[model samples]
Target: MKIKNLALAVAALYAGSAYALEPFVIKEIRVEGVQRTEPGTVFNYLPVKVGDRLDDDKAAASVKALYATGFFKDVRLEAEDGVLIVAVDERPTIFQININGSKDFDKDQLKKALKDNGLAESLIFDRALLDQATQELKRQYYAKGKYSVDIKATVTPLERNRVAINFDISEGAVATISQINIVGNQAFKEGELLDLFSQTTGGWFSWITKDDQYSKQKLSADLEALRSFYLNRGYLEFNVDSTVVSISPDKKKIYITVNLSEGKRYTVTDIKVGGELLVPEDEVRKLIRIKEGDVFSRELVNESTQSISDRLGNDGYAFANVNAVPELDRDKQTVAFTFFIDPGRRVYVRNINITGNTKTRDEVVRREMRQIEGGWYNASKIRRSKERVDLLGYFEDVNVETPQVPDSPDQVDVNVSVKEKPTGNVMAGIGYARGTGISFQASISQSNIFGSGKYLALGLNTSKSSKLYSISYSDPYYTPDGVSRGFDLYYRKVDPTQLSLGQYNTAGVGSSMRVGLPISEFDTVNFSLGIDRSEITLLTGAPQNYIDFVSAFGSRYTTLPATASWVRDGRDSALYPTRGALRRVESLVALPGGDLRYYTLSAQNQWFYPLSKTFTFMLNAEAGYANGYGGRPLPFFKNLYAGGIGSVRGYGTGTLGLKDSNGDALGGNRKVVANAELLFPIPGLKGDKSARLSVFGDAGSVWGSGDKMSFGDLRYSAGFGLTWVSPVGPLKFSVAKPFNPKDNDKVERFQFQLGTLF
Candidate 1:
């Protein structure tokens, strides 16, 4: 073995020295042994041509440049009869590269990523490139829990100037959290300290959330959270000293240690106000809720300063500023706060400027603004205009700026800029239910019509059991003063599941007028009035069980109904709601001249709570009751039915209400529902805005007879769903399982919809 190795080493040395030769002048330049490389490429790198002179210095420079091209290994220049000849041997690259250890990033995707970074099959790989690739791979691994990883690249040369590369990766065991220790904490227990951090020890879902991954970024954020927690509770001098992370010898477990300094708590000694005040000092002081004898809370101090500023703002001092400075006495454990106020000259808006709205018209933005030019500065109105602009989903970013007029100290100009996004969508999809049975729908709509920020939608659906066509329109700034208005018209044909009964076709046209008024910065009240006339065609399949109820309660042919509704919307956004409450109270009454005369009253309340940065919980409840007073009974078109995306998830569409003997929905009079969800991003799919995934639990039921409402009949469903914001708008897919099932219930394990949310 020693003799063979020595012979190989000597051959390598000879090959290296064969290219080192004295330079000679050239009469002609010729390239030998060229295949993939162009002849011009060799001539471009040659130091001597047919008419040029050659020397050792130029030859050495030429060799360096040729080698830097990374395409050749042995480059030699020879001269004979004053003719220059260049001979070269190319380096073989790994024609195929295969990786073996990856669970977080898909193999195909990782290969593509590597190719983008200049690591590809059949390419000449160097030590520098390999080192960079290894570091990048480790970064991706650390993003998960595999903190310790090993990678080995094995290259095997193949025939025809090629090689095959195989990367054997040993993805070390995932590191799990063994324990978390917090020192120098007295006001809170150890359990409380652990609860403050998102990371935790091993749990049932730790593999999914992966909270065990210890990163410097996460630790820094946790330390800031601890600081805020203590500051809000009057620990004015609290500080975090240091943090230590320890890993086990086996590299499968980790421990965290946090060192904190809990200084003395302080009480309020005195409060003082300085600087100019647009409002009376005594009146501004009343807005500060913090008392002298109370504990010194950082939150309260900030709140008090903000309250004072708001009070001044409402009084026309739009540029008022307030800052709180605290003086601490270590001996007495007391802190004194001083609030400095600055109220700039009261300025009126000189001009309202609009920009950044590429598609939306200037009129649309102007109409939504509450602050008007040549009017006294109103901070509340300016804030309202910003909110109104944000509510228009056409923009991804909306901001307002107040630039002072050059010559006018008392006048300022307002500028509103918006970023536009795609607002048109097309939807072509199908759905199935016991009653609808393989229904297909096609819809098209433009939420920002003609760049005017108006909504217009048209939809059509056809199925074996029914057909529907509808057109709807909405104007958020209907009156040029931020009031909202909308209207809808539809014609639908409903055929019961039991063909032996009958079918009903209904045609209606409706128009509604709405007005919106802001009750506060984050709340608004909307009132609407609408009237519609419907013509009902009773066909042959209306179940025998529902015939009696329909004949007694529903109208015979045509009916006219009038409705009035009051709604309050306090949500942050319509598409991705984080925090809000929606309350609606509506009443529909049959006209005296219509075929049916009756009244129905309904009220619903929905509340959304943000559990964390990535999770939200929603609760909703509704009730409706109808009684015959005059004329005929209520029409079937106005009856309420529950199920599907906006109701219970485990059942078919409109199947939550009372059912006839043949299992056809008879509609309902009362309904109630509650839902909870935990939302997070999908692992390895970060930065993708097309879809959002969540886990949810649903519970609710509907009752026809008010007195029969019972918890025993309540249905329960738990599932996970994926919401995709596709070009055709939002599409939702859910796989749900029933927690409790009844004998006659049709519990669907999977349900999906095109555009709806409950």
Candidate 2:
């Protein structure tokens, strides 16, 4: 026999004199010392079964395997008269895991973490596992900057081989960044560079923003931001040498230091394209933003590469590669660039998949996709698909990915993932607005009904002075070619005495049919035709013009109105826009069949430009003109008005218009409004883009039909405001001071708009 075999035989036979086994034929197997584990389970783990010859090797293997099950803390095998005996000292099962005195994290969350680490209730207990769970708890607290947190784990055995674990935690105060220093920066002031960082030392807003909290992840992001700041400004060789983070003795204060190397700025001396120019050289060359003699910017260089790749993608090359190689002349601080392009396999989309829409139908999303399955991939189309989905406003986020198909070089799949938002509401709310006063509204609407992407609404709005009821519906894909059709039915009653626009009451009931046609990706034209019946009631302070109109046209009149509108909305966000311009032009005409004859034309232009990483500058302008035509007058109730909430904020609602002898505002036929605002994130709400602050200047006016148009007549005001795209709806609040106010002009210092979907 081999020495190893002999040793095993000796060890197995001499293990226990009371129950020793040599080479024996086992008649039966019995398991002992198992309180919870089944006898069958013990037999299942045995390497040798009944009627099998049991040897030293088999006995040793059986014992090793039984111990490996982890159900037993100890396992021993014995044989008596050809019967194998399996004895095990079972490990106690964990009955419960308790975490106490943990305010920073929830007990359930900690338990889940332990479970993920293979330590949880009903699992076999081991001191090693307890140590593991303790370490995991400490790691979690440390991640939250709780460097002084202490965790003590205790295990208590119970009946039936069960145990309970308790983790007593002492989570100390979170370490806060007391100071942040940037070294070796010469191109910009220290404050300027620091302004680019998302992390900061303790400041007025630190409590909410948590910028003072020490985070390795945030530091890494800040370093990347610094790198981008230099690289975009022509410091092509800029780098972060090192970063040091220190905690005070009490582990409550953290100090951070960033060392940087700002290399000399370089200018582009020459730019050229090389390699596999599937497209025309001129076309690719024109895609580069960095021209000869221009300062070298890594951003522009990367843009050039992406553009080249996209241009190739337009021709069905899904995996195009564009490499920008630079030759540097250190003495002259200039760089010569060459872009090498490789148009890879022209792959086709194998399939299109949509996910994350619980209510929206798959077909609705599929219809919005510009990139179709089984077609050659187009980067522009894929991007457009994402934008179109976002424009639906049915989702909070949209992500599109094209993953290469396994083992298929020429195939890829388009995966569209969306995070849906609430697109339906059955809500009632009360709100106060500067112009509309206290208002009550109840609405039932579904913008994506059953995920079919149709819009339907029934609404009622009531105020002390006015009331409105409306029903509207729209099918955006009415014609399948992206044409939209909708109709509105509404009844409204208004009394202007309380509103201060004029001392009169007017009621109107109308219905309109609207049709929209998409002219391009970002532009749409809509036309609506409607018929309305209007009644006017002149009060004690009614204007002369209103009395005259009521007397000439009678108290009640019927009119047919037709409107046309064209809009190009290019803003990145419909709410809190930071970039792009929105242009809208509309015209309305009272048809020849109506009791009144007049025409109006209006234009609005708005631009949002990012001034810096932290600020956005927005400029908006609007103007309108209306006049009587064909020997008829523009209706008094239809006159254009400007001032207050949306116009000159410090001025009373519609009070910038001309005033009559009765001291009532008589709205005009011509109107103009202009606004300039600097928008920034609220101090402590940097991470929450749904809310923001803005300082704005507003100028507006309304000229009577007999008055001349002049920019000097525009009422001007300046103020700060808060805008929040809250979960319930959009809310805006403003406080303003008029720069100049005429003696008779009504001035209001504050204004707001808050309503459900108002």
| Alpha-carbon local distance difference test for all models | 0.72, 0.86
For residues 363-441, write the lDDT of model 2, one tens digit per residue. 8898889998888999999999998888899999999999999999999999999999999989888877776678898
Question: What's the distance in Å from true for residue 399, model 1?
Answer: 2.8
Candidate 2 — which residues are off by over 4 angstroms? 1-26, 51-60, 356-358, 419-422, 756-758
Which 10-residue span in candidate 1 carries the lowest summed lDDT? 1-10
Question: What is the per-residue lDDT of model 1 for residues 1-758, given as tens digits with 9 covering 90 to 100?
Answer: 00111111223333544334444556677777676677898788755567766654555656666777877867765566776666777777767888897766788876776776677876776656766776777777766667778778777877887777777778887888898899999999988877778777756656666777776687788888888788877789999998899989887888999999978888988989899876788997898878798887777888898888777766667778898888889999999988899887787898999988777889878877888888988877888888887777788888899888898888889989788888998878766444445668788999999898889989888776667787888877676545667776766665544321225555555555555665555555665555555555665656553466566656344445666667788877666776888888887776666566667888888788888665677777766766445745444545566665656777666666566565556665666766766655554333355666878787776676444989987888888877777764467777888788676566677877654311
TM-score of 1: 0.64
C-alpha RMSD in Å of predicted model 1 compared with the true structure: 10.0
Global CA lDDT of candidate 2, please? 0.86
Question: What are the TM-scores, per candidate, against the unseen true structure?
Answer: 0.64, 0.94
